[model samples]
Target chain A: MSGTLPSDSACYVYGIVPADAPVPEEVLGVGDPPAPVVPVQHGEVAALVSEIDPRRPLGTPQDLIGHARVLDAVAAGRTPVLPFRFGAVVRDAAAVTDELLAPQQERFLAALEGLEGFAQFTVRGAYRQDRVLREILEQRPDVARLREEIAALPEDASRYQQIRLGELVSEELTARARADADELAARLGPLAAATARADSSADQPVNASFLVAEDSWEEFERAADGLAATWEGRIDLRLLGPLAPYDFASQLVDARGRDSWD
Target chain B: MSVAPRSSNYMSRPSSSGLVDVIDLILDKGLVIDIYIRVSLVGIELLTIDARIVVASVDTYLRFAEAVNRLDITQDRSEGLPQLVNDMQEGGARHKTRGALEGVKEKVTDLIGGDGEEDEEEQEERPRRRTRPARKGREQ
Candidate 1:
């Protein structure tokens, strides 16, 4: 499957897996024609790839979905996959095999083996804005007093007070969010093989990914459900997973090299 | 936002439909092969950069402040101060505050000549990418 495609058509790589692993038959890759997904092998590892027009801009929602779909499909098929970052394109299948698959075969094989029975589960928690604000007001008398003072003033005249109130609220929210995120991480830490905290946004207090062994998935879910019940009305929790170990795979490959996994 | 009730199965299907979920997984989390070419994704770069621009700005602070001030007017002033605090603790207060904040956000965006609706429209107009057929028993 190498060196046959036109040079103008590059291979858009989705991920890499063991060469013996079954290719997900139904998956189509990124592009207007929706390039046929195929595997190019080197040693024990193979790259999941498809042809793409290199010149086309690739940020459309469809393109994003297409990239994710291919990777997710591989994971769903029970094969370990090391997903490539979206928009990973190469000159052609030959380059994919020679540069990506051949040179990195050992590392890829090790990473894939390490991730064999694990999948990524992302747990996102956002505060019920109102409840959090209420909690803050109850905790901070100064902020509550300031809020009252601003409320008493004329709308047009309370500009400085409004700014102060905004600053205080923002600060308090950040602090509370930090505490809550830590609490969540601590609670969920034992259930996973490894955990990584995702970048937090304003509303989301807890954005974390856990690399979980497939056997422990039930235990993890039950624990999460219990925590959700305990924090009901305070934090809204959403769990997404059984996904490709995207967050962990890249980190492991970079941090320890091929020998670390063994 | 209440948590969805736990289903019996442990391996929940991924929520890949929302734009935020897609961006979080695709752009931010994935394996990086050092030797390969990284394609310049024009729209993603633009969207991610633009999304960060409006957050935590002076406009957002003023809006938050304004919303707090408006909260006093809509609630019962006749009742004692403690009663007012009690009322704010309830869900009604949340809805009012959220609505007020959202209103201010829209107004501030309009005042700054930002076309929020046009961005949404452009996002909607982008062609839908095809996905694999839903696996049995996992359809949502």
Candidate 2:
């Protein structure tokens, strides 16, 4: 049994930081087999480090929690972080600082700068099935045929049957969401500084995160109120923010291979 | 990070404080750089697999069908299925039309990136590798 076991290697990663900041004593990195925070200092930014056993698999709920914990912990302290892509690890601290961190200093600095004093807000809504369906059937007979066909399926079915059904329903729902998005965006866009649209999940009918200015929170809420009135019960809207600008952060990298944080 | 589809839209009033989309803020769209000597990750191949769960089986279809069935039109006549389906059509249509069917690519490492690496000892707690969206997708 021991012979069959895979070998573990140390995994290193970097996470959010303020510009030209000192490393924190208790920096943590992602995984169930948690890694301690090691600061990989480039000119102004630092990559969080941990000695991870390379043989282990990452991305379990615990790993997700581990990742969130480290960044959240740092962000909570008001450190504007340039979050790294998950599964990022380096050989050692020196390489992390020189090759990874140093070269990307400008990008990191810019990212930190862009996010300063601003935060991210997430808005999610599920289709009010009862209301939406009623509205849909009343409005379009063409869709009704499809809906009627879906209704005819048995309660107990195979896995294959279910995926197909999910696909159809998802399509119908997305159609409604797109229109709803137009109306919602019209009302909500002005309130946000930037936005990222995400694919909707079964539970999350409309998944969108908005980057809003810190001072304009009240106005943002008011705008949501107006949207709620306009859409009524047809669409649901939820907002969460005044936190780190995680969503607004871009994935574009500069010449140095560092992400453009700003 | 591509979005998942199939769950029907809701009729309830939009939530005032939408924290459920929190996953969106953290998942993708962050920064990643290869600093100096790239840190040696453990079993990343396994980790990525765990994070990326694509829904493309019969189960997805049935659930979608179920949600569609559940959408009763007898109650309110103001809005019909066609109009609602039309609204959702763009969203769902894209699902079928686009070749980009990559499901849930979690960059859990940065936002939730840490010790998620699967080791032999932790396998017991982990659920089946093929979760197939199983009737219920992650609720917002």
Candidate 3:
């Protein structure tokens, strides 16, 4: 319940922040009977932690949410955090200070300063099935002809044309997705200090994240909504943000983050 | 008011709003220290479920062909396909493949002896959050 703790059970590490970072009170971290999060500080860096029983493992869906909720709540507020991968734990509070924080205090401090006033926001845009299908059919005569040919033939006879039509649609979708992703980057890129994208599919054209100054959040959301309005019935776009910089901060250390928007 | 009447297709939500939005970021991302971890992941399985639709395959092609087969593309706007579009939609829905997706929830579900995308993933809207309209014509 308090930052100060008894030296017994292992410490479950959630994230790293400045020593004085304000953790929300009564916030419980990963466990069945969740333990109250407490800070273990070393000079300017601190690890947000809670005591956990060594007998139990930490990989439950709720545990993942709990871990993220703690870090994201901090990110959503004022304090900037470098989120540690879930399931990170050290033997005791001393190990958190001596082994974790003390060894890399300067690197952690610099990363925190770099991210002091910013948070991560995500953009996901998926093509509406009905509308996109109509566009494809209208534009490609070959595709339309193939559709008709398949319809006239027996249910199983037009298998080759069916595959051919699907392949063409897939090709067209890939090209369109590339163009849309570029347009999306051009629109949202300037507003963000930095940007990173996730893998795009024919169905979902853009999966991206932006690092924006906290004060400029309203402006960014405005642009996203505008894009959504433009493609309202064609492509569905959603904005999620004030996140814990999971994308941008991947550079701080080697982690299994998502691949680029390719 | 800064907000005007917008369509039901899209909207923005906070990062804390739901697990569906950031599940991958929470699990696959963040800083990893090679130093120490005492928690035993002995029986826990890592399910790297790709939720995105795999667009290139004979089956997907067949589905796409079938979906296009339903479109009444050449006719006038209000007069074409009629209710045939609905039938095509049902046909496509019947074959919509979510083949690879099991996600962090499924991985953790395996660890705890559960079956699917658990509580938060299934709920479209959580209490105290704004109600999300059911997505129309969404790929199920």
List where candidate 3 sits over 4 angstroms from the true fold: A1-9, A53-57, A253-262, B1-10, B35-56, B72-140
lDDT (CA) per prediction: 0.61, 0.49, 0.63
Model 1 chain A poorest ten-residue lDDT run: A253-262
Per-residue accuracy of model 2 over B87-108 as CA lDDT, tens digit each: 2322332332111111122222
Please write out the lDDT profile of model 1 over residues B82-137, one tens digit for every residue: 22222221111122222222222223333223322343323322322212221121
Compare candidates 1 and 2 on DockQ and give the better one.
2
- Worst lDDT run of 10 residues, candidate 2 chain A, spans A253-262
**Candidate 2 local lDDT, A1-262, one digit each (tens):** 1122344545457475654555555543464556566665666677777777655655444444456556555553456666665566655555566566676678767767666655565665555556765555567676566555544665564344445545655566557777666666667777776666766543345666666655676676667656655656665555544444555555422322223322
Interface alpha-carbon RMSD, every candidate:
10.5, 9.4, 7.7
- Model 2 stretches astray by more than 4 angstroms: A1-11, A19-29, A33-38, A143-172, A199-205, A225-233, A242-244, A251-262, B1-25, B34-43, B49-65, B70-140
Candidate 1 structure quality by residue, lDDT tens digits, A48-167: 888777656555545656777777777756678889877677766777776777767777787887788777778876665556666667798897899898778887888888888877
Kindly report which residue pairs in candidate 1 clash with one another.
Answer: none
Tens-digit lDDT track of model 3 for A33-71: 788999999999899988776556455455666777787
